[model samples]
Target: MLCCFALSLVACATVPHTGRKQLNFVSDKQLNSIGAKAYSEILKREPVSENKTLNETVKRVADRIGKVADETDKPGFEWDVRLIDQDIPNAFCLPGGKIIVYKGILPYAKTEAGLAAIIGHEVAHAVARHGAERLSQQMALQGVGAVGSEIFKSTDGKLDEKTRAIIGALGFGATIGVILPYSRTHEFEADRIGQTYMASAGYEPEEAVKLWSRMSAIKKPPIPPWLSTHPADQDRVNKLIESSPDAQKKYQEVRDKIGLGVQLDVLMDQSDRQ
Candidate 1:
């Protein structure tokens, strides 16, 4: 237990953009290797979109976002993006910059800027190494469970099985109580960094707020912020709105210099119907 505590103290690392300290014992190479294997397995099971236009559009937007992320966040990641033929309104970026966008999300991400917002958010998660941090937290919790199990065994049935069960439940409850809030914090941080990435890539950061608003409108019953791994859509929208002014300024600066590259009106309109 003392050794585990010592290792955790030494493994503390700062998240990019947010600068929050997190316990991360996992190495990037190890995490990326795991992500690569999982991503390959997913590709085998799920159909990849053969729609050339959708694939091209996703690639275009992701490449722009990846450029900004490379400059500001993760320089060495081999960023690549693909569209899946799934109907689920979801997207994610795995470690080492493997990104997958679902076809169903295209409706909500109705514009190039909207797509940028979604991609940026997912890229922020990868850049922040949230997956590795979560894994490290789980490892620590498991270590705690192991220590507790050993101590309970030492009791040699002094406590009833029911008491042991209750203790285990309490440990699980505590871990959940801590980890869920941490996950929400990561979501909030990703929102902030994502807006910045979109802004840097010359997409309007305010579109992120609109994206979340659209998402909120579609959900029949929204998950409460405290209970979910992610913050509520409304909460995310509010935070994006709050942080967008600075991002807007950055966008204007980028636009003034580069003239707002990559207008995708036709592509966006076509994607919305799909």
Candidate 2:
């Protein structure tokens, strides 16, 4: 127990930009290995997008976002992005900077800037090491439960199976009740950092707000905020709108240094014609 606690203290680290303290005992290599394996498994199960132009566009935007993330957030990450032929309106970035975009999300993303918002946000989750932090927290909680069980066993009285079951339930409750809220915090932090990345990459940051607003309007049954893993769409949209001005300033600076970004609509139209 003492050893695990000591390790947790030593492994404490702060997230970039957000400056939030996180307990991450997992090593980058370990997390990356897990991410890589999972990514490979997913690719084997799901078909990669065959539309050449759409695939090219996804790579292009992802490359720009990945470059900025490398410079400011996660340097030397083995960044790779691919478009999957799925109709689900979802995307994700794995620990080693591997990103997969589902085809169904393209319509909602609307333009290159909108797609950048989605990619940037997902990549931000990786750059911020949210996955590692969550794993570390779970491990720590399990360790705590183990220690408690040990202490109970050492006592003069024997603990019944019912008592053990109660201890397990407490751990489960802690995970859902306490840890889930922390996950929501990570999502909001990712949204903020993601917009900044989009700006730094020469994409319009305000598009993030627009992207989420569109997401809010998408037809879907609502889940209560407390029971869901992600923040409510309206709440997320509000935060993105509030934070976009700062991101826009960064975008303007990047635009001044470089030429205008690629035209997403033209590229999409071209893809459609093909």
Candidate 3:
């Protein structure tokens, strides 16, 4: 068993920027192909925004962030960004570089710099291959569960009720102890790398801190950090603040700085008027 576990470590990959080692048993080509197909299906099913200005803004910000990501990691993702006319305040980047931003997120984004922070974070998730890493972790957990089942089998090769209950408890413990925490780790890592990406792309890194502050103020019931997939909003804001100095240095080095850039609310008001 020790030798087998050691052998699995050979499949570990290092995350860009962070240099954290991650297990990745999944094939990148297969995962990216799946991501591309899912992105295509989402485009067909979701309402793609027809608002020219919003679409342009999403593309522009996402492109700049994506460019930085590509240059840094050189993953060669076929990057595309689209605005979805939905009330959801969220954005995500699929494995092959499909970026989707919902219209509702604009108010929170507030400015191009804010949007860059958001997109940079999502792009970091893709560039770091978090999706594949997550899938690999799940597969590893399932394999462990299967092995446990075999070990706890009764004399007649049946799973006794006690054994089944124990297995279920172990699975629950793993979910709470291992899986959920790793998700929060991913979120924090994404925030760190995303802030850097925005800064490198010539957007002010402080916008990330301000953006999270806005997020923390939203009047929603909160889940405890241990129970949640994301770190608490305040915790995230604090982390961004702590990392701002480094990101700011990157921003300072950029030749073409776009500090805060265009105010998104102004564009929204104009769109509403027109």
- Give the best candidate by lDDT: 3
Q: For candidate 2, lDDT tens digit of each residue in 165-260? A: 332222111211222433568879989999999899888888889887776665556432212334447888889889988998899888877655
Which one wins by TM-score: 2 or 3?
3
Ranking by lDDT: 3, 2, 1
lDDT of 3 at 34: 56
Q: How well is each residue in 136-185 modelled by candidate 3, as lDDT tens digits? A: 66556566332232322223435454344332322111211222333767
- What is the lDDT for 83 in model 1? 86
lDDT scores for all predictions? 0.69, 0.71, 0.72
At residue 201, candidate 2 shows an lDDT of 89
lDDT of 1 at 52: 80
Alpha-carbon RMSD of each model? 9.0, 9.0, 8.6
Clash list (residue pairs), candidate 2: none
Model 2, stretches more than 4 Å misplaced? Answer: 1-8, 144-182, 222-229, 256-273
Candidate 1 stretches greater than 4 Å from native: 1-8, 144-182, 221-231, 256-274
Q: How high a TM-score does candidate 3 get? A: 0.80
